[model samples]
Target: MSTNKEMKTATASTLNQHVHPFDQLTGDEIIQTAAIVRQAKPEVDLVFNTITLKEPNKQVMLSYLGWDTSKPRITKVEREALVVILEKVTMKCYEAIVSLTHNTLKSWTYMPDVQPMLTMDDMFEVEELVLKDEKVIQECRELGITDMSCVFNDPWAIARHVSHPGREKRLMQALMYMRTCEEDNQYAHPLDFVPIIDLGLKKVIAIERIKPRDSKYSRPTIPLQQHNFLPEFVGEENYRKDVKPIIIQQPQGVSFTVKGNEIDWQKWNLRISMNYREGLVLHNISYQDGPEKRPLFYRISLSEMVVPYADTNTPHHRKHAFDVGEYGLGLCTNSLQLGCDCLGSIYYFDAVFNDHNGQPVEIPSAVCMHEEDYGILMKHTDYRNGRAHTIRSRRLVISQIVTVANYDYGLYYYFYQDGTFEYEVKATGELNTHVLAEDESAAGMGTIVAPQINAQYHQHFFTMRIDPMIDGQNNSVQQVDTYTLPYPTGHPKNPFGNGFTSDYTILKDTKEGQQNACYETQRFWKIVNTDRIHPYSKTPVGWKISSGHTAPFFAKDDSLVAERAGFAKKTLWVTPYDENQMFAGGFYCNQSGGDDTVEVWANREVQDIQQKDIVLWYTFGITHLPRVEDFPIMPVEYCGFTIKPCNFFIANPALDVPPTNKKINHSVLAHENSSKGEGPKSCCSTKL
Candidate 1:
């Protein structure tokens, strides 16, 4: 396939002035990149999987950003594209680095015995092929699926279930589903059979069922009962009636300034970008303290995540999904609506990715940004004069939502006025269900949410990659845990037996940095800059990482899910900053045999990691047991981690904020009558 599409070339001066070091590759840039790669390899037909910006070297980019004072400010940084291509004939993968700045190929290396992530076209093509195959039609007909128009399937990455045949081929297993109508929810009526397809040959290689057609364990017919959440099916009158109209408007416009991808809101400043794998990413995060800009993190993102189901059945045991690596979050992102996804004055950003044929695909409004009122920041009251001082709290939120098969994940990044950063994942969608046969027990494996539909137990583990710039580049991690005194009642240390102390341990090496969350001890890790001393506290300036709900790897040690998802086995991992070591689950994890992951990288050596440029890999998750109410649609489940200042700031950073004023707030008290009560009359007393 010849990619001879014409692209308008920009002048060198215009290109250098517009493109930032961290911006996503533009559409024109992507077209130019594919053309350059085709010119270098004219003899071979290449299919493009990923064509993204190859970020400049960290130190050099830092110098350009003026972070490195020792080196002169570098002006012109080369724009490079990291392209992954597949040979259509041989089915071999290759990683190429093309210089978009010079319009030349830099290097190309063939990847041995590996498969790239499944693209949107790959998923759609397999579904089409399976629906047309005679074998699949006959199998479905036997299961009472007479009309194939209502048949549906979800293409999932085959992690490592070697018990089945065809281990050498690039494959995907389609979990079959059937809907009563076109708009019906398919997950609520899952079929019993699964079709395995060889992506290279474009054919259904094998078919696996829950049990033999004559066996008692398998259900012979698809569940015809309708379970749907759409408005047309649920009826409009069934919706909530008490939800009043809440209008959020900014007459003076947004409080933030957007110049390209960088945003400056209140005292916080950061740049946001999106790619195919990690979705939304924050870069060059910092805060403006009066005239000084205090850098907190160089980059932060949801590096990788896995959803492993707990059903031990043959085909069901291979249900683990590497959402980030296998099917990129960016590719699955939804175009958010205005008043639904985000309210108030909002700013949106678009994402650019490549299709199978090396063409640019843009998902417009892929990111949503806005400010929200969060109750109160600080409050004080004096009894003497009945005077009060209160300051309203507000936060800046950058978020995106992605739908991966049965789950819709809403990823949000929040920045508060008190110099705190939060990352939250909201999981809500249709739960993956299967129709149960008579006398079949889902006791240990899953939960029967409906009459006969079973939703399996599962866990969603997320690995967040945090590269801190605390006060400077040189940083260290200290594991801090609170413990009660172990002395006797008569001893001098614990005379009251209520005494508690904190144990601080500086993680000196990679081995020592692999720590776990201890809830009994109230454990947390602090990323500190030893070189920067807080004069008042006489300690290192630092930020603390506080995680929410966490769980241990539930899969057995020798299981395929456990072997491939090694990053979820530990809660925290610290390693010296290396640009190439970004993902916790390695570069390619679609059909990975569980090698070259974060677990391997952290244990490669006992190198000293103290007082150096370091990155923190935090893995946190939730163990989900499907509920009866989670059938048609599941409510949002929240899990996240927070980063707060721990002596990094001399005092409360938000102390300078103006007090809450009735004139600006314009809030009214509700009353039984038509008339509304005016807000508090006294406003001057609440001034800060």
Candidate 2:
């Protein structure tokens, strides 16, 4: 290959007075002319310019030209006039050579960084010399034969070809060309050269294109679009207003007594009242009625007056009549006992009655009775002076009542060893059944219970009672009982309030051993935000679209079994054209106060448009699953997510921000012509 020093020396040697263009002058005459031009154009700086000339039979002629090179000015008027003459001569040279050789003369203009080579051997390998020269000559010949006289006139094209496979070379050539062109008096249309130079830039550096010898893998595919969509509940405002209110009422006829720190009940009874306009009946109530058979025929209903209680303030305590009416006679042996040797028994039964039309009605019921030995209740007894010992005594009290829709529906009563009676009842079927906690288990028992109960009578009713104790011991137990009725419509065993569907989709499988309690892995329903005071139309909607290329990925084990990873990142994508939006991991709500900006190409000009048809693309999610070897120092994976417009914005609100065009007068660019004295004769006046 030719070196810079050798090429520069050869070029200078070629500047002889014997050359055709300068043959009109002798050596002494050339020196005198040069001195005269130098003296007249003292401000001008001189620089050497190279040009390549081709002859017949693969011959090349390298020539040099001298011109002014002052700050911001390259040539004197004399040099400018000479350049015009030289351009015409060069055109003529092409025309004249057309007849001598079948090949046309293609002008290969390049930047200052392009060294002039006299032969193919100077720039290419010996084996490639003939092929490269032949290809160039063949192309020139074809152009000449076709009358295409302006073939290969672009300086950028020549520079790109010379810098092929070398990005650094291309950059150097581009920079030098821009600098030289600006300094030359031949600055006719310099701005038009930008695109030509950009076209020659290599897409990838040579170092990046190298492949590992043992690798045999293809690149991964990347999706062009991804976005996230968060759905909200619709009609939320109306649902909150329609739910019924529930009030907690206190228990009645309930009393407690303590004597010498021990309980001693002398009597026990229970009472219940039903206020349904029509008589009621309950079914499917069972218990150890007599320890012989599970008979289900015990039933009753309130017909008239409220059951009265004993008049005495102290009353018989446990011996009161209201106790009988409060605590129904149904009980079963499975019921728990409080004190040692208490031996409590529980029984279950159902109330049956008839409506105004005599139709059958039934409701499930349960009751428990205790029969403790007197020895347990006499725990604190003491003898003083042998005069009929007496120490302590206590009493047990219990009461319960349940009402539903203004109808008395449940009742409970308890008797204490200390002769106290307690009666209580409460309203039923008024409870909020949702609002689960995050760590709730799938078993449906937690700090709160919201069983989904429907109004349809035939639909099975389910209620989960968390005892937290069972089998006479504190063995935690969660019992879920389901009951089915025959009617099509009836009162709900449990009410539904704050109507809202719990719904969501799980993008990944639950981690092993995750309870997934109140933490539902899937979406049950869509939620929409309707609380905005204004209607949907009044709210401005906008979407921003963006796109980006992701970083390359590689396998964990460095195994060739898997394909070479390309841009595998999952990107967030939003489409204003379509309602669907997606994010790499999953769609989240489009609420504000987040990383709001979308990813876009670094060059903003690429997305300029007049309408709102922008689609934003974001990459996120796991690009590759980790392998065992990827443990300790796990390689970082590339992932990205984005949020973009979802038909949520009105048309260009920023249109009136500013207009971008401005005009300036070029008269300020004019300068006085100082090279008039040093004329075109300088071109012929050569010092050789």
Candidate 3:
């Protein structure tokens, strides 16, 4: 891990080298880009919000990458930076494009009525500003919180509910909590009042108190209870003693080779990069089959996500959080620890982002890469000969964990030996809790996890941006569903009543491209290239996507959440590829009023997506109804989708995988049974 100063010195020496277009910008690039903007606008001070790479156009990269390897490769490519700047004096936002290759500012435009993504510095300043406010201090004193140090606040971005002046400003609500000590968990003691801070004034504009259920209302006192999850606080002696540690050792080191940002493992090859908003991104994914390197996905990343609380009451209604757009996930990423975050032959990739002062800050171990045992891949047995064959499965995992205030999301990408890939989001963290009202019941719209803490019902919706190059760039989506033949029992097509077949529907345009999951029909979508077809199957070479556990958006159509996060309304969406259309929730969503989103884009102008360079946006989520066991902290709850080869391969892709061997596995029997050795003398076989 390189410190900021060390990285600055290192980047200064390496800035002249030609890096890949997909590679992340070095620290020197960030510093130089910021300098260019400051030099051009010397009249006022600038607050740097974000400075990231402006990715090269897809068409240019496709042509550059398609060049023959035998000939000299094209080495000239444009390097530019996209910057979001806030004027310190005017309180206005501006977007700038800087040509890093030429050391010049290319363009600058003012963004009207839009707030950029919240920075980590902005969050820290909110806490300090709240602690020092006289009104906040007086309110805390009335609630028996005399010490300002014991008061903790979580800064949350407010969702616009009306066209009022207050809603138009850059504002954030501070959810208050009380801690008994320095190490105590503050969530168990949620306060009844919340402080609203205006970023421009840097002061608390108002303090909104929780509404009383009856006419005889009084200020409620803060709960002075402890619900700790740390081992020391929760009696370490009460922990289980029977649990044993199982160690995984790769004596011969790892099976993957990494050259710069690119990794090659088992037949898969891909490049990985981290963005300031989107944490981890994979590019140019391909699989090696013999001498041919087949392209799969051009780029894949978690585009946007929103968590909308179900409570309809005041204050709580504004709890909808756009974690990706409002606050960058990359900024919240944890410095992953070995054994705690990942295990066995791990490789960590550090991420870099600009601070409020336009200096480069590095988050060490922002991405973790490793291999995991995936049980069995394939197994078969011949009963007559008592012969059995088993092949163990192994998968490569690329993952990152981000902490957005109270909740943590573990984003992972799993690649298998069978040319299959999966994206999973593991949600586990402290539930955003509140003070339960004395007159309300826990069963209404929230659950009382602790004595007085009400953990409200919330749904986490995530959208994955998939730019697939299954066989080639031009592809179409085929929605496949299985249905029973609509014929009489005695008809020729349905001699048996149990007969069923798959129905394939090609989504031609954006109007009909919006789709939902149908449990009764076993629905799945396939990304296919019509230019090529399997010789035997007589079908387009393709990859199919099957959604795992999912749910529908529960908010009303006219609600604020629906207008802002419209991508969650459907499970699948297809649109013609556009470089600027990276975020599903628009570019700026800190205080957005629902005008720009995937739903608006798809409906704004219908475009033919079939047999064209297209993009797929998949939305999936989990509706979390809090339980008693999820009090102090929550266990990992999983939701994801899988992509597998449909007819892209000629046959079973893992047929050639070698069977497991005792010498290689080093297995042991728990019980020393005399018949263990004589039971089955299995021979490891490899298919020709």
Top candidate when judged by TM-score against the true structure: 1
Model 3 C-alpha RMSD vs. true structure (Å) is 3.6
Misplaced by over 4 Å in model 1 are 1-17, 163-168, 212-218, 672-679, 682-688
Q: Residue 63 deviation, candidate 2, in Å?
A: 99
Arrange candidates by TM-score, descending: 1, 3, 2
lDDT of each: 0.86, 0.20, 0.85
Q: List TM-scores for all candidates, in order.
A: 0.95, 0.14, 0.95
Write down the TM-score for model 3.
0.95
Tell how far residue 610 is off in model 2, in angstroms.
90
Instruction: Tell me the tens digit of each residue's lDDT in model 3 across 118-237.
Output: 989999999999999998999998887789999999999977634344333778889998899878998998888888888878999889888644434465556778888997897878
Which 10-residue window in model 2 sums to the lowest lDDT? 456-465
Report per-prediction Cα RMSD to one decimal.
Answer: 5.0, 49.6, 3.6
Error of 1 at 533 (Å): 1.2
Considering lDDT, where higher is better, how would the candidates rank from best to worst? 1, 3, 2
lDDT of 1 by residue, 114-208 (tens): 88888898899988999999999998888777799989999999887575433357889999998888899998788888888888788998888
| lDDT pick, better of 1 and 2 | 1
Where is model 3 poorest over a 10-residue stretch in terms of lDDT? Answer: 1-10
**Any idea how many clashes model 2 has?**
85
Off by over 4 Å in 3: 1-18, 67-73, 161-168, 214-217, 671-688
